[model samples]
Target: MSTIKAVRGTRDLLPPETELWNRVEGVARKVFERYGFGEIRTPLFETTELFVRGVGEETDVVSKEMYTWEDRARAASEKAQSLTLRPENTAGVVRAYIEHKMDAAGGLRKLFYIGPQFRRERPQRGRYRQFWQIGAEVLGPVSSGAESAVRDAEVLEMLASLLDELGVKGWRLEVNSVGSSTDRPRYVAALRAALEPVKDQMCEDNRRRAETNPLRVLDSKAPEDQEIINGLPKIADYLDEASKEHFAQVLKALDACGVAYHVNPRLVRGLDYYTRTTFEFTVPDGSGLGTQNALLGGGRYDGLSEMLGGPKAPGIGFAIGEDRLILILQEQAAEQAESKMDAYIAPVGVEQNAAALALARELRRDGLRVEVGDGSFRLKKSFEAADKVAKAVVILGEDEVASGNLKVKRFATGEQRDVSRTELGAYLHGDQ
Candidate 1:
């Protein structure tokens, strides 16, 4: 028999690691709400055409990295339908928006989601086959280039503020504009001509990209590819008047908000749908987590909705990989101290299980996190487990329950006190 294991490029977010995931998610939800973005959930799988259309057929994600397959079960009854575990969220979100008629809702629909995305690729550190992303999208009423830029700036600022709130430091933001669909083709042509001479010297992957996605050639990680890319034409210089104006407006918004950013001419995003403002957040030293330390990346994709066969609704959004963000959190934890839990509960006797459950529920109802130990363990063992997880432990033993009181132990101070059930909730809530 073979031992089972997680597939390559995938990871199991264990308990300790899940703490950071929850923390990051909490911050993301709070920050997004502050920006007037509501949560939206979409299916993990979608028809194959969604990616091919919304993500762009020419992009590496659609052409190479997507995990696509036919519905084997449906093949017997009907024509086998091709489906893909979404490699990105934007296309599916757009599909949902169209199907649900959100476009008709009027005003800009600000929505956010946090979930897993799939891709088949050679994964390395900070890169995974299955990754999680916290994404936000704005649709409708993002009319003028200046309005679009301000929206981009707002999202970027919210994301940066989220990291700061979570104590993630030493990161910087990089910004650029990929231009509108009309201007991209001309820039692509210029890029192809510039890379024609050095194509042979570039990596095999990049050489292929030179023909298919000329902008991606500049995204190469290979040192030789970097050298060739450095000498390649700058896309910003090739931007048409509208594109130039759009880029300027985006920068002006960032400046007005006092959000520091640098223009990176070569920072084309991995997807083909991105247009106008594109940005990436990274460690200032240029060494993020490793060779690929870009913590978060996103851009405006104005044509994605139309590409998905919906009305011509332009959209702007960004996605941050949860795994990469967690990596940075771990580094920060090493430099500082980890956050402490609020409370833990232990039922000393099986008979006291209901009491413990009630007390635990009340603590949580008061907005204090409380973990309850299963009644199967001995009281001492339960207390030990509680000590490991919480700063304080509330014990619901038979004597305490009989007396209508609870024994609370402050784990950090080794202090113990007996409180009546009526006052316990108030004590935990700091009302005493």
Candidate 2:
């Protein structure tokens, strides 16, 4: 028998890769905080109805990709409750907001989350069974359609600024508006009529989409499917007056922020909840990891809360795949030098172990990150190990301890010198 490996669609982020993940996460946190969004965590799994209602029953995530399971606790009553490993964050966040009465908080409630989500599907590059998303949602008091569009532009601008600060290049933002339910159905009819002629020529997936989700057929990437979709009616052309005004406001806001964006008439996102103002950020040159390689995407879901049995609260948000962002950062980092470490502590003799440990703790307490050497290693070996991750190594030996001093070795220059015990901390800080 063959040894089993990680499930086909999942991946392990090991050591150096984890470093990149941390960097990307740090950037996300910093950017989100600047926009006044606090972090919120929801359970990994939620009751199945959340997705069934929030993400439409007709969507691929609900009909195909969700990882659903039975709650065995009610087995005695033969009443097994259905649960699903959350496929996305928005529904759970909204559920928590409603359950906790956050709407009563009286202002815009901004929340962000970073965690893993599960989906059951054939995994490919940039698409996984288990993946991580960094998401943010702003709910409450975004009453005017103009305000909603400004908020959308703000979030997208923040995201774009983050990528720019991190040195990521060659990305493009695609924007669209799917219109309200009132306007969308009419547009769907027009789309169906336009597609009826070539429906036979479309791939099987597009064919099924035509009957179930005609808008999704526009999202298909298969070359022939793209050709068929190109000739189809654009959603923007069929938008009602209110929907057109809403879309115009969103684009005007994007322009005010100097955010570069292209209007994509056929950019209907995968989920069913999306209404007006749908957008996606992608690497246009195709140098990223995934096919079509969208780095982030989202849209307004004005009716989702009400659909899920909550009040009529409208919300808008976006989710970015952290793994994909890290992969992109890794590719960028490869062209640059690695980050430097702060300090390393090499304790020379068993007799001086306690003293070295005490000094290490003191340095850490003073807010410096110090890595101590294992007592089993000799001074030279320990210094060699320290050199790999440290700019300077503190060598604590019996002779140095007896003299109330320590040897401060600078790794980059291969220079060694003695410092008085009281001055050791200052010397290290100065060197740093």
Residues 1-432 of candidate 1: C-alpha lDDT, one tens digit per residue: 999999888978877667767877988899889989999999999999888877878898989889999887745677877999999898888899888888675678889999999989888767799999999888873443314667787888887788788777888898888888887888899988988887988788988988888888877888856777898878787688888887887788878888888899889886878888899988644344766778888888888877777777778888888888877777666322245457777887677778778888887887787888877788789888987777778887778878988788887678898878888777766576
lDDT of each: 0.81, 0.81
| Winning candidate number (TM-score) | 2
Candidate 2 wrongly placed segments (more than 4 Å): 1-5, 14-16, 72-78, 141-147, 165-167, 284-287, 334-340, 346-359, 374-384, 391-432
lDDT of 2 by residue, 331-420 (tens): 656423334455787777677678778888888877766877876797679978888777788877777778887778887687888888
**Decoy 1 TM-score against native:** 0.82
TM-score of each: 0.82, 0.83
Candidate 1 has an lDDT of 0.81
